[model samples]
Target: MKTASFPSLRVEPKLRQDTESVLYDNESLSQFIESAVRQQVELRKANTEFLARGLASRDNARQTGQYVEAVDVLEKLQNRLDQHKAKHTTK
Candidate 1:
């Protein structure tokens, strides 16, 4: 893989020491920071995909006229639970 250099950043001494403590003795700070950045980017990408899927589901529900108010949905669930309890309860 091709390599690139980053401009120096000024960080607090304690923070730098903390980061170095977690890295292997032979690992450069740049490598550790790069790996962390890649992981964060991947996490953000996954979050974006999840949000897109949720929005698509909402859109589909709207298009089908299947969307209900939160209160209505909660009430329906409560009704089902009450019916279930009534059926199982004796006397």
Candidate 2:
């Protein structure tokens, strides 16, 4: 497959040096920047989906007049976490 290139980026010398300093052994600067961009894209996509789901849930609750209390939700989540930890704990 043909490959495309990102536009050249201009940054301060210190920032360039800092980024280079963090590069893994034998890893290229281009690879590092590409990985960072990919990670940010995924994070933004996840955040957008999370917000959409929450909004949909809110609208559905308003329409149905069926809502869960914050405390009750938290308590149930805590119980689940406790159970998971107990189950996974080494005896």
Candidate 3:
């Protein structure tokens, strides 16, 4: 596949130095920037999907006239969080 290139970016010297300071050994600035861009793309996509699902759930609840109580939802979430914490703490 033909590879495409991103436009050259210019930053303040201090910003460039800060980025370089955190790079893993032998990693290039281009590689680091590409990885960062890819991560942001993935995060944005996940957020979009999450919002879509939430909206769909809201619409479904409104249509069905069967909605969970906030207290019940919070209790379930808290229980799940507690279970997760307990599982990790035992490890």
Whole-model Cα lDDT of every candidate shown, in order: 0.94, 0.99, 0.98
- Screening candidate 2 with a backbone cut-off below 3 angstroms (N, C-alpha, C), the clashing residue pairs are none
For model 2, residues 1-91, the per-residue Cα lDDT tens digits are: 9999999999999999999999999999999999999999999999999999999999999999999999999999999999999999998
Q: CA shift at 87, candidate 2, in angstroms?
A: 4.9
**Model 2, residue 75: C-alpha shift (Å):** 0.8
- Clash number for candidate 2: 0
Clashes in candidate 3: how many? Answer: 0
Where in model 2 is the C-alpha error above 4 Å?
A: 87-91
- TM-score of every prediction relative to native: 0.63, 0.88, 0.92
* lDDT by residue (tens digit), candidate 1, 1-91: 9988778889999999999999988899988999998999999999999999989989999899887799998999999999999999999
lDDT of 3 by residue, 1-91 (tens): 9999999999999999999999999999999999999999999999999999999999999999999999999999999999999989955
Q: How close is candidate 2 to the true structure, as a TM-score?
A: 0.88
RMSD of each: 8.6, 1.6, 1.4
Clashing residue pair totals per candidate (backbone < 3 A): 0, 0, 0
Question: In candidate 1, where is summed lDDT lowest over 10 consecutive residues?
Answer: 3-12
Higher-scoring candidate on TM-score, 1 or 2: 2
